[model samples]
Target: MALVCFGIDKFPDHCNFVNGGDGSVSTQTVEKTSTNRKLAPRYRVLLHNDDYNPMEYVVQVLMSTVPGLTQPQAVSIMMEAHTNGLALVITCALEHAEFYCETLKNHGLTSTIEPDE
Candidate 1:
């Protein structure tokens, strides 16, 4: 793509400059659009199992740190971590993921977050 820009404007990305044949400067409006709405990048909160914290405590933390997590779901996540050494606690936006990860850490649990592929 080739572009010839004149001066910096408020809407630099959406405007183009062109020289008119009559020696006049004209501004062309080129709308930038996206066919699909951009989705927020998601992050994965991971729980790493250890021999220190008790299984029941882990389940409780999972349920308390993340809202709307039922007991069965918490148990499943805890059991997965216990059996597999690691488990995905939740997939959400960065702020929520960070909050959840920090909350889990505050509760004496090993947790981390990574970009969800």
Candidate 2:
């Protein structure tokens, strides 16, 4: 049950050795990798105001179509769209954004996807 610290200056970028109660010693190494690759571009899922779709229907569609959208969040988005001409529902990867946009459209709600700045 003895704990020994090695290369404390390096902290998390170093290795750790632990002694178990069964008289066994284990070695664990912590590694950090630096990647130069850029992340995938994100897209914005926008809900457009419409005359045909009801407010409640828009909220329901937004909550169902987009993942991680809460009821209050959906209502806020719907209200935004109602007040303005459009509202941003979410910012996510292109495929996910497209899927959400399509799902909203299928539910008779006006939605679109555009590259996020």
Candidate 3:
């Protein structure tokens, strides 16, 4: 690319400059980003403590939905939900979080997903 200028009396007929044609100069920079791009909305799925759901059942649900959570970890989460009236079950894409919430509800447990904020 080139830029040119023209004047009637004060300047020359034209002034030209190469913008970016050779390898010596770069006109644009491309940035590489991480491949793990997140497209879905981020959500926090929470389990609400309730009288209808048994503690053991809560633990089971936690273990199943939360990836890498063990039996003891599930129990701990259950206790937190029981005592605190609410506990974060998982942080994930909105679709998965909603699925988890619905599964918990199907199991007769009170659950919901909200924005992480």
Candidate 4:
């Protein structure tokens, strides 16, 4: 008599066995579940204030790179960046965030990505 276990670890939390005489084979379904927990460090792309960069240019950058930000929203964020010295441009995976920061820099705007505190 042999038993087969599926969809579970080698040492299953539960087990099922089948009899040879019966025509039906027993199936065991093991599901691994997970909840959203703060696992890895998250990153945020930020725009920093600069005396040299024009506010309109910052607004343009925000409108171009940061999705879903309207002209007004972009202007608001840019103004915050100006007054507060830093403003969040976007939140995403580190690679993407870093790419955005670099792109902002390439566009002659001061930007950076750091782990969200």
Candidate 5:
């Protein structure tokens, strides 16, 4: 008579077992079952105020470079940058924030990304 069992570490007692005709026992222990998963760090995309680019151009760039950014949102960001010297355009994954910042830079706008805290 043999018994084989398989179970996750989180629930050691909760197992599925099978009986073998021979007198042997086997058990499969599931490795660490983590409840918490690490998430990728987020970043903030910022647009800096610059004298070179026009307000309308800034708005256009904001609208086009960042996904889901509406015209009204773009205008608001541009205005904020104009008044405050900088404005947060978006908060997203590092890669996306970098891409957006670079795209804005390509259009002659000052942009930067920083880890979201």
Candidate 6:
């Protein structure tokens, strides 16, 4: 009938339930339901090779469009696209991926976003 945590919240996860009639501790265990929240789905922003935009331009655009992209990282992404025909620029939330893809397109670069599998 009384909830006693013994003044500590982390000793035993379950609280002891007492029965007033028999003055005996009940064996029924109280379980806490853990919240397993699924994360928001992410999308991958991809850069495609194009003959129109120069390699330097693509690197610059990538650097400008995606924050925290260093020059070396941008160069690597550009090189990947140049050599393989396509490269993943970033894997992020849907909105962010869309914005990055559109920004790259606006800069005359070939860019697309696909759901990360």
TM-score of each: 0.70, 0.69, 0.63, 0.66, 0.76, 0.71
Which candidate model has the greater TM-score, 5 or 6? 5
Best model number under TM-score: 5
Instruction: Kindly indicate the candidate among 5 and 6 with the higher lDDT.
Output: 6
lDDT (Cα, 0-100) at 26 in candidate 1:
70
What lDDT tens digits, residue by residue, belong to model 2 across residues 1-117?
A: 667576678665366778987989887776756868999999999989999988988888888887788999999999999999899999999989989989998998888889999
Cα lDDT for residue 12, model 6? 62
- The residue ranges of model 2 lying beyond 4 angstroms of the native Cα positions read 1-34
Q: Write the per-residue lDDT of candidate 5 for residues 1-117, one digit (tens) a residue.
A: 444454446646545444555654455444556689789999999999988888888888888898889999999999999999989999999989989999998989999999999
Candidate 2 contains a number of clashing pairs equal to 0
lDDT of 3 at 62: 75
Tens digits of per-residue lDDT, candidate 1, 1-117, equal 234574566657667867776677777888767889789999999999999998888988898899999999999999999999999999999999999999999999999999999
Off by over 4 Å in 3: 1-39
Model 5: residues with Cα > 4 Å off, grouped in runs: 1-25, 29-32
What's the lDDT of the predicted structure labeled candidate 4?
0.81
- Top-lDDT structure, candidate number: 1
Task: Write candidate 4's Cα lDDT for 1-117 as tens digits.
Answer: 657554466646555555566667664555566867886667999989999988888889888887787998888889899889998888888888988899899889999888988
Please give the range of 10 consecutive residues that has the lowest summed lDDT in model 3.
23-32
lDDT by residue (tens digit), candidate 3, 17-37: 336656443223334456896
In the predicted model 4, the residue pairs found to clash are none
User: What TM-score does prediction 1 earn?
Assistant: 0.70
